[model samples]
Target: MKDRIALIGLGQMGLPIATRLATAFDVVAFDISAERRELASRHAGIEATDDLIKLDSEAVIVVSLPNPAISRSVLQQLAPHLHEGATVIETSTVLPDDVREWQRMLEPSGVRVIDAAVLSGVAQMEQGKATLLVGGEDAVLADVQPVLEAIGGAGVERFGALGAGMAAKVVNNGVAHAVMVVLVEAFAMARAEGVALTDIAKMLDREDGGLQRPLNHRIMQRMAAGDFDGGMPLEAARKDSTLALAMAQRSGTPLFATQAAQTVYDIASGTGLGRKDYSAIAQLWEGWTDRGLAYGA
Candidate 1:
């Protein structure tokens, strides 16, 4: 007989993840929505239910609720019914503390909790191309490796203990979402300056240009090495930003992200980092928090 997997939540991401898991295991899918339960029942190798009790016998349970509150509520209801030695893989985008709380709540009953944060969308999950940022005991992960591989293909990375997966997911989303807003702000400035959108896009897409230069080339390398000596100095970068702001003002373009970024360069310049590499702006955070970002710091 095939291994049984209980999946709670059949929303956009959850539905695709459930279908993917069904390819390798007999999935008992649950949802509060009658429509979703019906939809899941139609899929092969899936048994849909509205009851949490039906999930009790499954050795592996995956929770993919919308938010922390709903995830907490559903897990609370299901916790009492979970049999000993059952492992719960939580794929919700929640805080690291939330994952720790769930682990605390479930440990008394011998129920293991693993934060398996999905790093991609529904389309990726359906295609088994989603990356799973996982955190849990090594032995626990080893036991459920097959189920995770079934859903994420080969894109599973275990960060550390229980809450680390959620931490990685949070950091990844923070960078991605912030960059998206910065891109919009950049495009607005470019459009205002009469620059062709396609040309701006191509320029940013270049490996030796804007985007890759900071991430894959000079800036990250400089930051990682803590070697903010004599590259394009912070003073020069500040001057360039000043010129961009001036151009935006002339074209009546409101710059939010760029303007905010300029404040960082201004602060760094004022702190006598003007002669250091422009990436020294990153040092502001470390200085403020009394933390270190460099490899040996």
Candidate 2:
């Protein structure tokens, strides 16, 4: 029989991971909203319920929550119910130290904790293309590789020890956001200075004399196509940006452009563009400068 798994939090990230897990395991899921659970139950292997108490003592518990406090709350609440051999997989975007602390808390219950941070957003998770960064004992992760494979269709990379995966994810996302803020601001100025976005696109297309990365192609293509809705939403991006800034501050690293970029996202999120893609920062530029670079005006 396939091992039983209990998935908590059926929001954007949770729903996709739960649905995907249902394909390979018998999944029992919980969400604060009935609608989300109803939506998740459409999958073949899902059994949605409202009771956290129904989680089996031996069930592998996978949590995809919004923040550390919530993760700790759920862990504390579920500790007694979890079986001795069960594992709790945390996939939230949080500090690596948070995972270490969670592990320490759960240690007495004999329920193991693993830092399994998902490195992509809702759309990617739905398509089974999300990447998983795992940090735990080698033997524990090895035993759960199948579940990781089911959700992180691209692959899983085990960094090392208890907190490494979270650190890697935090840094990776911080760098990506920092770079995007630069792109948004620079392109806005380029359009303001009377350079056609088409001209800039042409320059970027050439491999020889441009800032080159696969992300450059994706963001440009998204701008050219005017399809920014399905990517990482602005609110989520803003949260990550703030977290990134905090992470930088803690490390005493004076990061450039990150705060300015985060401010842009803050404005966009406040103006009811939270559900839109992070690329929609270009819209904020259009509003401020009365110029067009992202949606081609």
Q: lDDT of model 1 at residue 39?
A: 88
Backbone N/Cα/C clashes per model:
0, 1
lDDT of 2 by residue, 99-188 (tens): 999888888878788888999888999998999998999877877788888889988989899889999999899978767766665466
lDDT of 1: 0.89
| Model 2 root mean square deviation, Cα atoms | 15.3
TM-score of each: 0.96, 0.69
Candidate 2: which pairs clash? 57-83
Global lDDT of each model? Answer: 0.89, 0.81
Note each model's CA RMSD in angstroms. 1.6, 15.3
Judge candidate 1 at residue 169 and give its lDDT: 96
